[model samples]
Target chain A: MRKIGKQEIEDMAVGAALLGTGGGGDPYIGKLMALQAIEEYGEVTLLEVDEVPDDALVVPSSMMGAPTVMLEKAPSGEEAISAFKQLEEYLGKKIFGTFPIEAGGVNSMLPFALAARLGLPVIDVDGMGRAFPELQMVTFYLDGISATPAIIADEKGNTALLSTIDNVWTERIARAATIQMGGSVMNAMYSMNGKNLKDSGITNILKLEEEIGKSIRLAKENNVNPIEKVLKTVGGFELFKGKVSDINRKTETGFARGVATFEGLYENKGETLQLRFQNEHLIAQTENRLLCVTPDLIAVLDAETGLPITTEGIRYGARCVVIGIPCHPKWRTEKGIATVGPKYFGYEVDYVPVEDLAKKGVTL
Target chain B: MRKIGKQEIEDMAVGAALLGTGGGGDPYIGKLMALQAIEEYGEVTLLEVDEVPDDALVVPSSMMGAPTVMLEKAPSGEEAISAFKQLEEYLGKKIFGTFPIEAGGVNSMLPFALAARLGLPVIDVDGMGRAFPELQMVTFYLDGISATPAIIADEKGNTALLSTIDNVWTERIARAATIQMGGSVMNAMYSMNGKNLKDSGITNILKLEEEIGKSIRLAKENNVNPIEKVLKTVGGFELFKGKVSDINRKTETGFARGVATFEGLYENKGETLQLRFQNEHLIAQTENRLLCVTPDLIAVLDAETGLPITTEGIRYGARCVVIGIPCHPKWRTEKGIATVGPKYFGYEVDYVPVEDLAKKGVTL
Candidate 1:
């Protein structure tokens, strides 16, 4: 295990934001809070899933709700600790370690803060390699893990422990409760051991996140194009190069969903790239071709900084570069596609892997 | 203390339905479930609040969500037991007894069923004298009690334990979960002791429910005015004797809310009464004067059968009688009126007790 210091939080947040795919909630506040917690609690240990014992209980903890609401109802730090302890007491087992449910924004950072507070390690993995709107959207759930005996808590010291028939019910019920708990809550759910974590979790997303963050930081220092650096580090490709022209966003079914349209720039002028999202960017298309979709990363980055520009942050007249990363292999399977595919999101298109979509004029 | 047998179930259902106002969900399935449990478990003991040990843990248990959905998800009779047992496990104490959270429909009967299943006594009292749409509207809340450390469970062996910032948060969050739990969930909450129960509960509503049911049954058998018998039994007054004119209902924010209008019959021929409700009847008025409002009782019964009709059960051209019963004394206080009064229900009128409304030609 290695210790995560202050500098790692920014790197974690940056990578988490990129993986956020335009929704995982803003990481700015979480980054700051994580830094504060680290400063107070010394530092958090990062433990490999392989290092954990099979009998050790590992729980993933994070904030769940609308990103917009989460911004307003900033947690009191103690919310997570309280929830974790209470959950432990209810489970009658001490949590051995913690992990983030998804590789995105605030959630990717919350477990670190919780681990620091509890003197435990943050597992070096996550349920989803990228963010999705619902609890059932997680890879762990797709891998047949139950997201139950969950707890939803607010800073007001109010906590709710939930056990549902399935992960879908967990998401539905948790979302409603979050709306009432001032629209945001801290949750500790999906208790699994090392064996299940290794089998169900997306392996080494923390290393991937750090490496991705490091590439951007290095490129920025050397005044190089972050787009190329980001592409090289994550085995990704450029989907579009453009300036955000028209953006529209709205909240639907307890989720922030909308579309961001971009007018091409440089070599791609006169072409339009349209990005549709529900919490995380799910689809990218042009007037003629469907470029990428859910379970395939659709990340919009600041043209100069390579910083992730979230769905809520998309504004008119902002330059951006869209990148696509191949989703975890598990998400590309028949069940994965069926669970996170375009059709699952109400689209008629079939699942076409990003690696196979190279016939178009975009950079690979 | 008394043992509640199958004979008392019908009377309880009848009176509970009356107290349901326009909603509390249909109690038929709940009655049947209770009867079956009683037949198997023998009978449930009804314990007085005073009989409970001062330190005994007492949790009020019931179904939560739109009453309509509950009609479909007819519980497997294990939901309440699961929730109660889960709550008991969470509290880490033996539940000395159980009580109904509200004096309406399913909630009124669920405790007895739960008690029978668990071999525990059902307290002959409730948190609310009459049903209200929201959890915060309970007399326990009005009397400065908290409805936290609660548990919600569905028939699929799923249970959610909730401890919110307040009863209002608990209701809002729990309702959202119930909607997701297929629209009806059994919950065990408000784990207070005998002292708190005596201080906050609306006492003797179970006996009252029995008396009202018996009076209507006897009156109907003797071919007398069942409406008068109902009033005489509950210390209530005739609000209106009419034929159903129009009933328009719709669900809003998780509560079954609607307006039921009646055209007067008998001696009050030409007058009309419009009842507006959200879960329970909250307002009663003609074109001008307000007849009776919330915290007070507003019961609509079939003219011939004297059977209580729920909001979901209200239909066009149904002949009915509306009776107004004086609220529990605690509900008549300033705090009571403020918490569940006409103004609280969005009416622009001052609350006048049902007895006082007699001077205004409405009820006495």
Candidate 2:
């Protein structure tokens, strides 16, 4: 097991924000929170799913709601532990460990803070290798794990536990609660045994975050392109390099969804790309065709600092580079495609692997 | 203590509907459901607060959401029990009895139904002697009793446990859940011991319903004014006796709020009166003066059958009699006025006791 300290938390925030694809809420505040937690509680232990005992109760959790709202009404840090303790009390069992529900955005750092506070180890894997908008959009859900019997808690010491007919209902019910609880809440759910996590979890997510962060840092030191380094280290594709020229944002059904148009720079001059999002960046499009679609990774990073720009923070003048990575093998299956494919997001086209799209030059 | 049989359920629905003041949702379905449970599990026992053991766990329950939705999507009859059982499991103890959270519409009968299913007794008392729209509008809340740790369940066997700072947060969180769970849900909350109920409850509400029903029935048989009989029985006042000339309804913030206008009939011919409501009849008015307001009762009953008309069932052309009952002495307190008064419902005028208005004779 590895110990995640302040430095590791910082690096993971950078990497997770990149993987956030412009959603999953803002990571800056979450990073600060985690740093404070580490300062108070020392290092957090990280355990692989296989290393945990078979009887261990592992809970995966994240913050649910509009990322922009998180910036305005910050979490009290106690919200997560309140939800966790409520679930523990209700189930009449101790939670053996905590883990990230997804590997992207603020969620990826919340568990670290939670682990430090609770004095528990965090599982080395995540439910989703990257973030998706809805609570049900997770690899564990796709693998047949239930999301019910979940606990929701707000800053005001209010907590709710849910056991829905399905994960979809879990998302629907929890979203409403989150909205009513001032548009943000911490959720602890999908209480599975260690054995189940080993079977369904996206393994090596922490390691992947580390590699992505390390690669970017090294590239920066060497005066090389951070986007190229991120792509090479994670086997991702550099989709576009551009300046954000136009953007549109609207909240629909309790989610912030919009499009960000980027004007290409350097060799790709005069070309434009559009990124569509609902919490998470869902689709990347060229004028004529789709460049990439989730559960494939779409990361938007600052051209200079190598820092990631959250969707809520994406303004009209920021320079950014877009990168795409192949989803985990599990998410490439028929059911996975059905859950988070282009069509699932209301796009007309079928899924085209990001690697295939990256080979063609911007010949136009 | 007494056992409430099928006949009592029937009578209580009638009286409860009168007290609902056109809001508590349709009582017909709940009445039928209670009858069915009585057939299956025999008559449910009813316990007075004073008769219970101090340590016995007492849970109050009701349905939350738009009553109109409950009409289209019939309950599975297992929703309340599911929540109850989940609470039992969570508390790690057996709940000795159940009670109505409010003496409004369907809530008045749901406890009987749930009791029959769970082999538990229904308490003779409730948190509210009559219904108000919001969850926190109960006497339990007004008396400083917390609404959590609460449980919410859907027909599909899903359950949620909530722990809020106060009853207001509980209502806010649960209302959102109700809306998402197809606009209605069964909630079991305010789990207290017998002593707590003795302190915060509106005692003998079931007996009050029984008295109201018997009074209306006797009035109908004797060919006397049923509204007058109701007033005498409950120590109420005749707010207006008229023909329903105009009615308007609109859903706001998840509660059906509207106005019902009545043209005077009989001895009070040629006068006009208006009854305003949000879930329940909250205001009684003449052309220029306010007659009564909540938590005082403002019931509208059919002129002939004396059957109460729910707010959702109020129409443009039904002849009706409006009766106003004095609020419980508890509700006469300053805090109670703040909790459920004309001002609380966004009215311009202050609250006036019903008897005072009835004495002045609808003077021009």
Candidate 3:
């Protein structure tokens, strides 16, 4: 195990925002929260998944709701502790460690904030290698892990402990309650033993996020193009370079749902790109080609700084590079595709690997 | 203490419906559920509020949703038991008895259904002497009794255990989850010790309901007009006699909200009565005069048989008699009125006791 100091947190936030794919909340806010916690409580220990005993219980600490709401009403830190305490009380056991449920600006950094205060280790594993909008869109869910016996606590001192028949039901009920609880809540869910985590989780996610962050940070000093460095680090393919033309967004049913349109620049001047999202970027397409779809990670990066821009941060005139990375292998399975593929998100496209689509110019 | 059999269940259902004030669920369905439970589990024991020991734990059994939805999706007995079992586990104490949270057909009789199955005593007490739409509109709320550590369970085996800052948050979160869970769910909330029940609850509500039911049933045998007997038994006043003219209802946001209009008949000819409700009747008015308003009870009954008709049961041409009864003295307090008053429900009229309104002929 190693300590996660302020520098690690700062780099991780940048990388986490990249992996968040335009959802998971603002990285700046997430960084401030973690930085503040570590400032007060000192550095938190970071444990590899295998460091936890087979029987020791681990839970992921994350937030659920529209990212826009979270921006205005940042958590006060107490809610996360309250959720963990409530879950422990109900489960009749102490949590051994905590981890990010998904790789988002807020979600990826939240565990560190919580771990610092609670003195719990931050595990290196995560449920999703990249972010998805709904709670059940995780590799753990594909492997049949239950999300119930879940606790969601709001900043207002209100909480709801849900026990649902399936992970989907948990999402439906929890999402509704989240909206009523002021559009955001801290969740202590998917409590499982180390054995289950090692079997189903995407391991070394934090390491990869930190590496991605470090690559972006050092690019300027090293006299290398930051976007090119990021692309090389993540093994991602450049889909398009464009200037934002328009964005249509609205917060509805506890989700930030919208589409962003881009006018291609430089190498692909005539093409128009459309990116659709529900909390996270789910689809990216150009006029005649399907660039990428869900179960694939799509991220928007500032062309010069290589810093990821969240869906809410996309400005009308911003120039950006859109890239796609293949999701974890677990999401390529038939069951995984059914859970979060294009069809599940209401797109009619069939499942196709981003690598294959990048190689052969798949027509929409 | 006494044994509550099928006969008592049948009588209590009618009385509960009248007290529901056209908002509680249908008495027929409530009677059937209690009767079926009694048939299988044998009679449930009824305990007086004073009979319960001060330290004994008690919880109320009820349902929250649009009444229209409950009609289509009746709860399986398993949901109620699941809710109770979950709550008991959370509190780490055995519940001594169960009581009704409110005086509605389904709310009142649900206690007996659950008590019989669990072999627990049914307490003859309720938080509301008359039904109100929101969970916090009760005497218990006015007395500062908490509704938390509450559980709401759906027939599909999903349950939510909520602990909120206050009862109002409990209602808001639970109602949203209920809608997601399937529009209706059984609730186990407002848990308190027996002493709190004695102090805050309306005692002997079951006995009074049974009497009302018995009076209606034996009216023909006693050779008296059922309406007159009902008025005498409950000390209520006739507000209007009318034939139903129009009803505009829609179930939205987990509440059955609408208005029903009536064309006057007999002594009330040429007058039009308008009744507005959200789960329970909240107001009644004529063009120039205000007839009744909550927290006073406004019930609609069959003009001939004196049987109560639920908001969902009101038909376009049925002859009916609207009656008004003074709520328990507890509900007349400043807090109680503010909790369920006309203003709270978005009505502009000031609250006047039904008796005062009846005697002075209050203008709109």
Error of 2 at B64 (Å): 1.5
| Candidate 1 chain B, poorest ten consecutive residues by summed lDDT | B355-364
* Candidate 1 per-residue C-alpha lDDT over A1-364 given as tens digits, one digit per residue, 9 for 90 to 100: 8989988888888899999998888788878778888999889999888888988899998888765665776787788888889878877899999999998777888887778788989989998898887788888888888888888888787788888778887887788778777788888888887899988898789888888888899999999988899999889888889998899888877777788999999977998988998888988988876778888998999998998888888889999999988999999888899888899888777778887774553332
* Candidate 3 residue spans exceeding 4 A from truth: none
- Which number leads on TM-score? 3
DockQ of every candidate: 0.73, 0.82, 0.94
TM-score winner, 1 or 2? 2
TM-score of each: 0.92, 0.94, 0.97
lDDT of 1 at A131: 85
* Top model number, lDDT: 3
- Provide the global lDDT of candidate 2 against the true structure: 0.83
lDDT by residue (A44-144, candidate 3, tens digit) is: 99999889999999999999886567778889999999999999988889999999999766789989889999999999999989888889988899989
Docking class of 2: high
Error of 2 at B327 (Å): 1.5
